[model samples]
Target: MSGPVSSTPAALTAPPKSPKVAPAPPAPAAPTLRDSNNNNNNNNNNNNNVVIDGILSKLLGARQTADGSCARVQLTNRELLEVTRRAQQVFSEESMLLRVSPPLRVFGDLHGQFRDFLLLLDQTGLPPGTRFLFLGDYVDRGEQSLEVVTLLFALKVRFPTSVFLLRGNHEVQPVNRRYGFFQEVTSRYNLEIYARFGSAFAYMPVAAVVGEKIFCVHGGISPRLHNLDQIRDIPRPARVPKQGLLTDLLWADPHPAAENFTDNLERGGGVPGAFRFRPHMSRPPALYKRPRIFCRSTTTHYLLGA
Candidate 1:
């Protein structure tokens, strides 16, 4: 349900390095879904079918009510380019990646906790030369989503590489509309800036590889994702589009069982149509197929092998 949390293993320890501005490579082309033997089963076949049917049906119906609304509202390439340029200007290249000595700090689900976030920064001693990779969910569900975004934007501006921002489910469109982000933006800034920032989120990378060993993301792994490349091939939206691809990522819960190639059912005990996981667990024991492990500090449930 939450992002992956790991201990700072001694073997994986490395010092932070100064940020380097490598030339941004051309964005990878979006992957096309072809009929593959791996997904020949009724369940796997239904996944793509459900996505297409839902998107097409929604677009077809929305076309009648609004003329070119989707086209007009969608983020343009020019807008995205401008945001990136501004971001580059605000944050120095070196700020993007910091070389912390050993024992990295991992934080989860800030959910716009501005004061608490500040406390975390103070406690962790983040800014000067430490690397902090935030696993999404930065906004929403808190009173100060705007402050949280502003602070993060400032941090990114100050230390881009040191503070890595990954895309979270809440960062997408429909969820923002329902949650506090859109309203917070409109109230704090103007609708124009709100829309602009929304567009910028599309450019945010979905996953980050820390030290080439640990993988970090806002949400858990999906059935659609097998190898890391499969995740990379997913289209990055400039703005949250209808049918909620980004939303699915933010909300999708990961289970250890789903990671097993042998396990057919999803973490939520469903047929895996459109990758929906069940919302509730009948009992805590029935929830996970494996043993539950607890951290000495927090009692929240997490997969042992995960």
Candidate 2:
């Protein structure tokens, strides 16, 4: 995928620093929207659209300044909950492994840098007009995880077919709790809302196949997965487990020097089986099939020589 994504440590590891300066002009105002819901799911579509629009405007219209940082104004608890709920409904219908065609923009870990996320959209054009496949890690590490994720969910709801989100290791609660997302959410809202975000994350697809040749994931390949069918067979609405296929898919790394699958000491050694590997040795032929595997981890585990 794009000629062996660079595995160099700084590639996806650092968030772009916001330039220190005055705020940029505000984005154009969107229509004021009413927050409403109904029992009939179909009837709620209009309300969902309105809610998402408001959320987007609030997030997209964030005050930008130099220092590469932007201001953050938290969304109401109800609005945040609605975004997660609608996003879950869309994600619930997708396969654990999405099959996507090309002419797409595949993004790596954003790590909650909302301004950079905005700049990417600004440069690449937004959804519907331009298709995007996000390799997760939408939250944690940076200051605006809430803004980043909320904007993502709003865009997903606004254009479900055009935006694809894969689950990353950080999307799960355990890692985020230890990182920064949990504190960010609980500091503003409460435990229940944070839990709802986790529930939605549970439904996120973990991997994708672009143009039927490029395999994209947040982490690296799994020995347990021999074929696309096995990946599809993975059940959703589930947490990223401590071990097994899903765990490997979300946390595994690649090592050019590895002789075989080995413990990933970088990720707290030996908890999940076979976390690092040499491509030719560890990958199943059925899954490899000359496909370029795209992996973006904070640790920079891009598998290039497969």
- RMSD per candidate (Å) reads 18.4, 7.2
Question: How displaced is residue 263 in candidate 1, in Å?
Answer: 13
For residue 216, model 2's alpha carbon misses the true position, in angstroms, by: 0.5
User: Model 2, range 3-85, lDDT digits (tens) per residue?
Assistant: 22222222012223345365343343453432222233465687567677878777766777556478786788889889999
Model 1, 122-185: lDDT tens per residue?
A: 3444332455666677778886675565546544543444556666666666677667888876
**TM-score per candidate, in order?**
0.53, 0.83
Q: Kindly give the number of clashing pairs for every candidate.
A: 14, 8
Regions of candidate 1 where Cα sits further than 4 Å from its true position: 1-85, 88-103, 238-249, 255-306
Per-residue lDDT of 2 in model 1:
24
- Model 1 gets an lDDT of 0.44
- Model 2: which residue pairs collide? 18-67, 18-68, 18-69, 19-66, 19-67, 19-68, 20-66, 20-67
